[model samples]
Target: MQATDNVTLDNCADEPIHIPGSIQPHGALLAFDIDGALQAWSDNAPQLLDLTLALGAPLASLPLPAEVHAIAAECRDLIEDGEAPAIALEVAIGTHQFDCIVHAYAARIIIEFELREVPSDAVAAFALKAHAAIDRFKRQKSIDSLLQLATEQVRAITGFDRVMAYRFHQDDSGDVTAESLRDELEPYLGRRYPASDIPAQARRLYIINTLRLIADINYRPSPLVGRAGAAPLDLSHSVLRSVSPVHIEYLQNMGVGASMSVSIVVNGRLWGLLACHHMTALQVPYSIRMAADVMAQVIASIVQSIEARERALMAEQSAAVRTRVMETLLHHDEPARALLQHAPALCLSLQAEALVVAQYGKLMVHGDIDLALAERMVASLPQSGDEIIERSALGDWPEELRDALAPWAGMLALRFDPSTSGWLLALRREQINTIRWAGRPDKIVRVGPLGPRLTPRGSFDEWRETVRGRAVPWDATARLAAGQLLGEMHRASVARHVETDRARSQLLAMLGHDLRGPLHSINMAATVLQHGGAAGTMSTRIQASSGRMERLISQVLDMSRLNGGLSLGLEKNLVDLVPALQDLLDESRIASPGLRIVADLPPALPLMMDSDRMMQVVSNLVSNARHHGAQGEAIEVTLAERGDTVVLEVRNVAPPIGAEMVANLYSPLKHTSVGNVHNRGGLGLGLYIAQQIVHQHGGEIAYRYEEPQVVFAVSLPRN
Candidate 1:
């Protein structure tokens, strides 16, 4: 199957190139149906195969050699078994031997013949050369060194004028990454070729064929002779198949007579090529070609091994960075602020030109980044996706934002938190390159023997072009590093929150326990003063202050227990809630005489609940309203039954809570303020404790601001 997307041969001459209905003059092709009847034969087949045959001629009827007949029979059986076999062997006809390649494709059997002129020791020589190359490959440490070694080995093995290890870029362009050429020849090393040089269709063919050889660019293409009305022969698998005329012209323009390309496929994708060019027509025997194929496979495996090791090393380094950053974040109360100090290190580790961290409505940038641009980039990020969004080319970005990105050509943004609008963005600067093309990359339309069509450029001299607006494309390693850092950041944030909460809970528990003794002694002294008939205003004030202190300590201890994941120790009973509300309101009114409070209660409503805990809930809510409500406004408490549930609403006239504060409204120890409504007094735990108490009773507590009134509604099931 052909590869798709950007490399598709659709609407192009690639499809026609696959079945060109011809073969090169240096070889001959004969195609047969599954039943061994001659379907097609190249015009040169008679001269190369030493046969006098016509279309529809049976293999047994033809005057071909017996070896050809035996190979055809073997191929037929394999084809019948649904196995496409590419078998190569030596065959002799009229005292002349030729290399015969046979393969089956789509129920058709193709036999290709090439003249073999190698010495008797050719195989032995190739084996020694290949073994030495393999040894050198094993000793190479880096990919560049391996590629250079491969080029040298291939050039020595093939005897080509120039051997280049060409690498394909993200944009399909190619660079001569490593080269081995004759000393007197001009070096094409380090030269770049536009993607158009090898059209998408040709690249596809390279992947399927793996080895392509053009023995002579000047060789005439002998058309296949077949029935006039029959479909053209499919020579996609023909070893002696004729190549595209445009490519032949392309090589001729560069003054190249012979060329061969061995594809370097990594992980099943065409990665690059070991391209060999000779100044004169040259034919490499099948043995040498097979040896080259083995070398290419070895090179591909080594490339994969090297890349995998590099990725593993990157993962190890990224993990170390994550640990250091996470520890720093956990140590500081303000994680975002702490992260800013390590942004430079993070940017370096990510191989980024700059790094921007957006957290809790703030932007912190490291390296050469404009603050305003960073802010705009943060705003451009999607608010909700957890997946990393990356683009290596600035052209892939929105046109409006492209200019603003300026020197930066790539952006990688990831939003780690779904609840907050923040992102971790890594930027890469433009790699502005000066490309030296082997020829002018532009293809022109001109009249040729094939007719008016796209023709190859006539120039082969170095054509220099400046390329910009691209970066040293981000790879999987960068993505992995970014993801790892964000994951650790998330984990560390949770850990820090837990640690802070734990420490606060511990302090409150200790303070509450220590104050109990002093509070109890004060209460006892007040009681003695009252009993001695000397209880004056001073004694009354002392008793009231001590009582308030005792209530505050009790709330602190309760909040501490709740924060520590301990459940409330409640005593249950089937009791009426009206009396409890009334008693709580009476006490609240007595305690805060200046503050007006009112209640709307049903006379008798009984439920299965902890009556003391129920009183605590009501008292906490009432206390919250009294503390946070608008001055001179009355606190309204309503207890009503609604079908299967009872709703207790503590409504007070207060300013609306800010949206930001509302998220943490029921959180313990949060000091929330909106406009004039300040959250002051009493440890900020009343609403939180009330919420937990309601939850333990299989009920829910909710808060909403309705115009001038803030409502805290507690709903419980009426069993």
Candidate 2:
């Protein structure tokens, strides 16, 4: 005997249930080798078949009818070709009829015979009902509807006391989703069963053997008598395989005398079961059982179709959101800011309670979250890779993080790209799940006919279990959508880097070209002073060249600091903005002799600001106007106070900026030649740096084209 034949509570999972070495007493089993010599026979075969058996006698020597030999020949060919499970036929022996099932395995032919009194009309009647049931199934609009109708039809066709449509969850637990029962029976709908009820090995058998029946739980088992040193038969696909003792005990405890289950296999996986139970021993004929099996297969197909359609719809919605986010990234220079603008929509699409984006060393969050706490969560993730981390509950988190993740239990984090130091997180709030199980799942050890073993629990009363600190489990579709979104985001990030590199190359080219003139002028002036010719003029020329170089280098440095996420280091003091503007305009006229600079200023509009930096802001705006404005156009500068707000406006007359240039106005190292009269030669960092500086002073800056003039405006609070 195998070690699992005498199983204990701890080793129940190791039981080799497929090779039980026996068959249920309702049928008789016979095995013959290729030479037609009887090799194995069940003990009850003599009484059930009314025949005498010999250990090594050929099947042609037996008293069985000649028809049996002819049918067996056809079955051997079909089995060898993998065409069907087995060939079933009704045969007569003297005055009795039996359902004969024949198949071949290991070069041996196995046959099972079960006595039946089926009438001629039964087959035609079941076929008609089966066709009608399938026609109605095609009308079902949803899976639940189809399943409920299926349970009703199976119960009607088999005359069972109760039938239930059960579905398995990702955790291996099952729920009775639909049921059809007699009016007097108690309802089992909406009840749940724990994963322990169906062990892993049992589930594997279910997938292989689609239909199983136990005529009577109390019936005795008939042991197979084999030749000496015969190997135990593998009865995984046997029609009359005996049920496990523990499983029989389990049904007995549920007050069921006979039971049947048809597996619902979807895409090669066991999705659920069609369970039927009888209050008393009731033997269903093989024909009716086959009909029930066909119904189950139909149900599995319909379920797969409906679920696929729903998942496709969800994917379409997710794709729409992805498109919008990608467009925002392409249009805006700052990815973090652009993503934050669509946080609400993204959270909704992902079915998440909150969202966090960490990119470019900046943290952006939505839905009432602390920045420091979010940073901590980001730090806990691996520094690189596109690995995804998913957690369904706070209890699943590390002990140190459990308390911190309270109220927010589920987390789906994606570290999409190794090239970028960033993470995207979608969070769900804690949801308390209340489950009502059919019984307490824990088994009790008891001494029974088989020695000490774990027995099924005697009580099957309704048991309620409260599960805490968990959100609704994320389904496979949601996880797939998350992966798709991250992939798109990674691609967009790579594109941004490529564009930035191109801009840097352009800046290097422009700087090299512009700096050459200043250096050449300085060298020429130095040589003139060395010759002691025009000493004052050479000194003046050198000072002008040095000033130009200083301005260009300063602009580059400011842009670099802003790009690195560093502060401008403002030193604030209560200052008069009116004087700052006047000084800027006065310096503008001196630098550009032909350009007319006009100002509109209040006598004294005082505010808190860094005087030098604030002046630099105005100076850059004026310089940009001078370079890009129309020839001989007056540059207008205005400063005023409007109810606790100080306003600054610089206006220049020029043609409207091109749409492409306007879109990338604040991007660094841009070069554009609008017209011959307008001079645009610089690193293109003036507006970008000016915007950053104004943002540091708790102010707003914006640009607009008003008819014949292009206007740049800055607004700061007067405090």
Candidate 3:
């Protein structure tokens, strides 16, 4: 019989165990290895055992070694009956006893004693220590420092040989940035491994199985299939464990004897791995491995903080640099060429040896380089609007740039604009190796009698290779700043262009207004002379010329006002469409007596529109059709209401507008020189101006080509 005071059980492996009623029961199981420390069992173990005993059957005490198996079997039956009890098992090493208790639910295990009972304060202190560790991790701010500190903490807790913070690159390669190694072991810090070494399939497996353990990479298989009562673990949860067999094989191939890795997740994505490796064959019990995983949680938070700080700093610096460049460029009042000439010295602070300016698809300014070489560099650049850089051999000159200085050794080219053949800036770095080889014996003969002629240490070929086949020296942040500066420069250029255009338009408007008064006076005087005098040939000719001059003045004034952004005042009224059409027809008949004119106006069609602008729109279309149509052909004006708009159309019977003319008729300065087959007389601004006026009144003008005739139509909003 076991001594009641000593509470010792030895070789009692097969004996029935009794729990003291004085100890409060909680559903938790604890296991301790004789060679190591204690391990906590799942909280559900006690409840499972209680349910097993409540099924109207006497409980049998299993031997110590077979306790786990017996409890699993009983729990399975209790789970089926829906009344599993929580159980706590404490394996005592010194006493050679296994203490067991059953509870209906999970609660603290308090072993109450009268005089010298189990130390309750010591157990509570252990719990507090674990909670404090987690709290310290939660309060960390810097990710780099957090990772470094966490690795040290985990190493101290678990006694692992080397702990590392491994990060995955964009290409799936992995890098070890931080590591904590024992004093005896050499460091494997700042090492990068290729993605191919891991393979794509293995990475996918790692993400699925969050935590993995290769207890002994060289350990022979136990050949025990399906350890009993092993619940299926969902590794996707924050606290779950699953190991992949393939990873074990990989570690073995890498000559690693033992390995453990935990996934570091950020924003729901697998960020990297927290890996520990041991060269000598070793095994970390499940409890210590869990502690390492908990520490990894703290490391993840620290990394995120560091990355956020770095990104914020880079953005702030880029903004500051861009602001400085814009202020410097806009400080001067000069042409783009003068500004760029001083820009390299001012903006780059003379860091660059040379500067070049390209404008209107030509090299306008260059410094410290021959014009031919400058042109060649510009030609090699891409024609796209965005800035670009290129590298090429200096000796092989294309036909377009044959005369440049003896081949360029190295060069950097930037294109400002491709549309107007704008400027290209080129900076040349001459080849020095070629100069040193000119007189050396190594250049002339292969065999040298004088212990080999002097040879140059650094060659142009070496320098060229260093700079070639690589992106521009600027980083992403610097390039972004440069792009912002270019945008400001382009805006200044565009502003200058707008101001110039406005000034020219204003001048033309004033000239047209001044000419209109004199031309109107001439027309009035001519009309009086033609009626008061004998209506002679000279009198008639003067009147016709005066009328033409008046028309020209009116066109110029109207174009000026339109370009000046004069608004059209629209007075809405219900006006019958027939009378307007009849009035236009009478004017057209008087203007050309020999031409046949027809009016098909609907009496009930009424429109709400600016009447004056509408009349001008109709007159422009009718006159254009008549002028372009054949002699003696009938010109038809039609009006009707369709849907929500009133439609007015003027059709002429004449030769069809040629395909080329039809496509470009409304474009300004589109002069067609097709001999007698094409007639090009006006500035091509009439239809454009007419379209604008019609659009201003909420109407649209369109043209259709019908065989032997062309129709111009205007649609206005209806009342």
Candidate 4:
């Protein structure tokens, strides 16, 4: 339908396009009663069949051939079951041969007769023709080309004088988008038609049936013989249903004697109509109509595919544009300057004539447009939120803004953030278009002999009208890409906030966590000295606590270096890993009398590593094992030479650790709490610092849960 929010259809919505009660002249129709008695017949039927009007005569006694009787019987069976059936059979009555279609409708049995032709190989020829037509549809590269090809192929198969692909707008009005016809006929392509031509009921029927044909519009109608208590027939599904008198007049007014229509459905909705028109009587077999329906289906499928491909292509291109714009926004400190510098390429990518950037309350205008008007427009639009994707004509805007917005006809605005209201607005200058209607589209009613009657235009002359105040339409793909861009920007904005918040939080936690142990150690030593403990013991306590604080400061420095992606500045030396680990083990044992420790190592196995850092890595592993390991199980440290590498393995027994907790231990400045929060003293950066030191020495450190043992393995390059 038309993209405008205000849709007006005049009398089109009320017109009854269906319920027409007349058949075309090319086919004669007869209505029969439940007893197979001829009750009512079209005026042309009497002359064509050489029979006089005998209202109550049973059709079986009309002296027709046996085939006609059998056709009548099949029709009766269908009628009894409330089914409308089309049966094709040859009839010979008084030396006259004809092809008859016996159809069963509610309240009456209608028989339609046509002059049949005998083709040498109709089935084989039709199959080949259908294949060729479908191949043509597959080869089309665009929706326009495919629609044009479809009409041409349908015309070739059905032998209609003219065929057109008519597309319906959102308001139910339509235009002939593509047409193929005899060279002698006038073209109807691009001619607009009002929705009254095919009302809601007709559109619904087309969706269900897919095909309908009026062999000849000039024919008289056969009235259904009414039973005493029967209601009118609901002929909505009848193949040979009579056309409404209004539709009959409409066709005759258009000078179309014969017509047919096939529905093009896409995504389960009626997308458009493939209409066929003829100047004279025409008849096509049901099989031919079936083939045409298939072609219409193929066209629908291709339309959906082309639309999807276009969307995918738009998204790919939009992503590149968004990425470039994002980079500019991130690097440039000024929003207005960045927008102005990128406006040309950005407008081109969005197909906009002007661009506007509204950040906070400040507005910036760019591209070809009135600067004052754009600033006002951006200022008027909402500064925050991405909820509504507003698109409207300039005329419909507020009176205050409309006068200033004269330079453009439409505006599209999107807010990237709710708090800051970072909005991006695009504007398009008014696009004036000339539309051609089949006739005076406004004058759809004609004052006729009896009354004011609704009819198709009597003339096909071009009636042109200039359309203004509307911009070039933004397609679905463009809208989708715009939405995606806003989403990306919103995510980026939130991430920046989180990053800033995390930096502040990390600094406070670091000070508290790193100083807790040192202050506690000093207080304990002073308390011992005041209590008259031996001077040597108190001195040793003070020295040990002081040494521990110095080591912690060193670790904090190492962590800072790693955060900046700097090396540990290793002091490498040939050192025995076994002895270094042994020294730490002995100290831990003395510190914790209840600690269980074990060592399995080859004596004097030396390796080149940062001697001080290697000792720290071993010490951290041993400390972590003692704190979390099973209370009575041995904390084992194994060192060996494996090929060209020195491997140090520490094993402890503990409960399974959660993945999130393990991640927290390795991540920077991340802790549930400081000091005793982990049920152990000191900061939570030991393993992280150890891993960095190992990396600086060109060695590897890894952790794994080994059933009863939680294993930490360190492999150093033995050079």
Tens digit of per-residue lDDT, candidate 1, span 8-117: 22324454788887888777888887777888898878876678877788877887777877887888777755347688888777756688888898778888888777
- List the candidates' TM-scores in order: 0.68, 0.86, 0.39, 0.58
Whole-model lDDT values for every prediction:
0.79, 0.81, 0.51, 0.73
Question: Quick one: best lDDT, which candidate?
Answer: 2
* Lowest summed lDDT window (length 10), candidate 4: 1-10
Model 2: lDDT to the true structure: 0.81
Candidate 2 at residue 255, lDDT? Answer: 97
* Model 2 CA lDDT for position 290: 85
Instruction: Score residue 48 of candidate 3 by CA lDDT.
Output: 28
* Candidate 3 lDDT for residue 122: 42
Q: Name the candidate that leads on TM-score.
A: 2
Clash count for each candidate, listed in order shown? 0, 0, 20, 11
Error of 3 at 81 (Å): 27
Of candidates 3 and 2, the better by lDDT: 2
| Ranking according to lDDT, highest score first | 2, 1, 4, 3
Error of 4 at 29 (Å): 7.1
lDDT of 4 by residue, 1-719 (tens): 22333333434445444444444455566767777877666566677777776767788777656787788888788675555557766565554445677777665676767554535267348757988989888988898898998888898888999999998776677899999999999899999886767767778888877888888787666544433344444456555667766666778878898999999888777888999999997877656776898888888899989878977777788888888777765543334446667787767667788888866555677777666777777667754444545665766576787766665877778776566556788788877878787877754555556445455557668899888777876766667767776766666667645653674477457666666666787888899889997889878878877777777677677766654435678877778777777787898899889888889988788777777778888888988888888778999989888999989899999877788776555544455545554434455668878877776676778888989789999988888
lDDT of 2 by residue, 7-113 (tens): 44445676789889899988888888766778899999888778899888888787776777777777766665333357788888767777888877766778888
Model 1 TM-score, all chains together: 0.68
Model 3 over residues 506-553: C-alpha lDDT tens digits? 545544544454466566667777678545754665665566556555
